[model samples]
Target: MTSGGRIEITGLTKRFGSFVAVDDLTFTVEPGRITGFLGPNGAGKTTTLRMLLGLVSPTSGSATIDGTAYQDLADPLGTVGAALEATNFHPGRSGRDHLRVLATAAGIPIARVDEMLEMTGIPAFARRRAGTYSLGMRQRLALAAALLGDPGVLILDEPANGLDPEGIHWLRGFLRHLSTDQHKTILVSSHLLQEVEQTVDDVVIIANGVLVKQGAMADMRGGGGAVVRTPDPARLSEALAGRGLTATPGSDGELVVGTEDLRLVGEAAHEAGLPVWQLSRKAADLEELFLELTSGTNRNLGPGPTEGVA
Candidate 1:
């Protein structure tokens, strides 16, 4: 666990035939914290990450770990650990066997297999064949395999893809511990907003193969946009507009004040003599912000695919 090393990508572009998968993308993953890689399905997040891991050749630009490409590193496994997909496992191999095989390939110690299994809490089923294991079990095994070399940085793509709620919860805590306590630099990608919200300290948002924004979650959320709920919605809206504050109608006639100062909203309601049903400030949750940034909207219809459900 290394607390902080810099991963810098500059003008990184990848093209598949005429289709540009990634368009001059650039970002950094700081050590000692999780950096989330987010985008819509066609946003090229997976392609960018693959390039970062040396799995794909970029048509232009570059991704570097400590200013060096992953392939150029002497010991690439020691530099980065990755869990790209759950289906990357061999069906005939046992959980422990799978880790052992990768550890051998990486020149890691055989003992690391048991150690990772124990640490990941999958030792009880370590001897179970991988194909027979449930989705949750496969996720754990994949994670264990990634940790085989005890690399300083981790690159994971949709690690929570098939996990149950409890498994997702476990992974969230585990990743945080690896970054905070173990000091591993982690870059994880996922479409699950709630899980990413719980796990990451920073976020890099992308849409339609283009970079949208990237920064600490606190900074983004604190930059003057928050929801303000009130009992007298109509009166509050009028009061806010009078005071030069931007307020919008949220679902069910709730007033959402898109301003920084919570006090301003409160004072306006009080000055207008409106009843304070509720004046609590609400930051857009990760899910809300994700949709807003990716889909460019905040309307939640149902759990179904949309124009760009990435």
Candidate 2:
């Protein structure tokens, strides 16, 4: 069985004419973990993926899998699988035929085609023309083709774009199976913040082709603040502000303190002589962190779980 590889992007930069598509970006995708690649529109996420796949050349720096560049890999298809665009399949070709063609080109066994079809849950409609299939079905077909070689590293971009809720749920479970059960390295880029929040074990966020943050999902969530409900919300807010903590207002007269330290809130409330009815760690919010990281500049977002793959 093939083994997964760590993805290392080192000071990668891409230039199209005068505009910079990717800046001096660097990050890593750990093996056996699903890493979410997130960025706003025109943030050079596609460019970074293209460079990593060797589809586009980097103006400077390099992207490597297990220290070997994609072009230099002994078995490219068997080592790295990517589905950047699900719509790249031929409209007239059957889904099974598409995988077969890819298998033949990659020198993979034709038997793997059926296996992938079954794995992707497209065996029932495998013979149907890709043009006749819905967007979600096409996504499944594309995924089947990508898995034909059983590559250790999987890269997907916006794979959930056309998926229904059920499809998305299945995708989450499928990716998890690949990562945990098979120990495959998966890097998925998607705009669905909520879905990304739920799916990925780690995240790499970029803005203007620059890396803004990258770390474990748990660390990101763990850095989140705590919620509190005090009778004197303003006084509590002022008290927290004096300690260099921001207290944002949440719904139903709740105070969202900017620290994960529950004891800090308790002590502050106690000192203020305020009756603290409730105080607890707020829910993990990847969206809020993402927005805050990408808002003003592409610079690193202050301090927190922004350190992982150095």
Candidate 3:
């Protein structure tokens, strides 16, 4: 039997007055997987999430968690947990108290509050007022509140914001554990593509409030430029270009060469007598592919509704 958490968005659209924030978006997030939701600023990602969480009404169509609308779920907070913003907590409330209030409101056990604080690594600081918490600490408190119900589905937007490197590493492992061990369905919206590439099992890309691409992370591999880490990236770029390959700046101080053939990168380095440190075809083309797909469509791709409808 299926473990149950599955998100289905069908022909979903949202409009703010005359502006089309999300248009005809459709995708599925399966159980036991981490799906990355990516789009540029003003891409309607926030609008869609709001509609899905029932915080805002959709202009048309539907967004459902576990095949039921979020508001219609027998236990809305218990079935779907969303941590959209870290700054929403009350400044006067302690972390433990904030979670306890949510738990009490949802009829969830009080014990889950402490468990979530411990699970999110904020138990020691649980008694501190939220106003004293750092941005990262607020983020952890928000996450602890989201998990207080032990929800089957998680929706996180920019979850890595304000997280240090060590915290990020912990989150990565923690999310993977949630998906793999607990079979929870997760949708993470992030502008940090490299971190998304490392953490997500699938990706759903959108632009101008429209679905652009969606697929398994594995499918994004294979046909990609080689991402090379070298001591001399300028020289390496020149070498790769001399071999008739175009090179571009990639994430993390790496040079991306346009060619799927692994030998081409190796040969170019060997020909230039340059010592190569690392080379791989994994996720090398994601940035390029994302830009290629959303380039001209990111800003006001098309008109929507009647102007000044609000």
User: Which candidate's lDDT is highest?
Assistant: 2
> How high is the CA lDDT of each candidate model?
0.79, 0.85, 0.83
lDDT of 1 by residue, 29-96 (tens): 98888998887666777778888888888888989988889889887877788888787878988888
Best by TM-score: 2
lDDT (tens digit, per residue) of candidate 3 on 74-153: 97777888899898878999999999888888898899888889899998999999999988888888888877778889
- Model 2, 1-310: lDDT tens digits are 5558999999997766556677898999998899999888667787889889998889999999999999999989889989888888889999889888888888888999999988888889988999999989988888887788889999998888789999999999999999998999999986556777889999998887788888888888886689999999999998888788899898899999988899988888898999999999987776887888877664332232221111
Give the Cα error of residue 102 in candidate 2, in Å.
1.6
RMSD (Cα, Å) of candidate 3?
A: 5.5
* lDDT of candidate 1 at residue 110, scale 0 to 100: 99
Candidate 1 clashes between residue pairs 3 or more apart in a chain or in different chains? 40-310, 41-310
Q: What is the clash count for each candidate, in the order shown?
A: 2, 0, 0
TM-score of 1: 0.85
Clashes of 2: 0
Model 1 segments beyond 4 Å from truth?
Answer: 1-4, 222-239, 246-254, 270-277, 285-288, 296-310
lDDT of 3 at 17: 62
Q: Arrange candidates by lDDT, highest first: which order?
A: 2, 3, 1
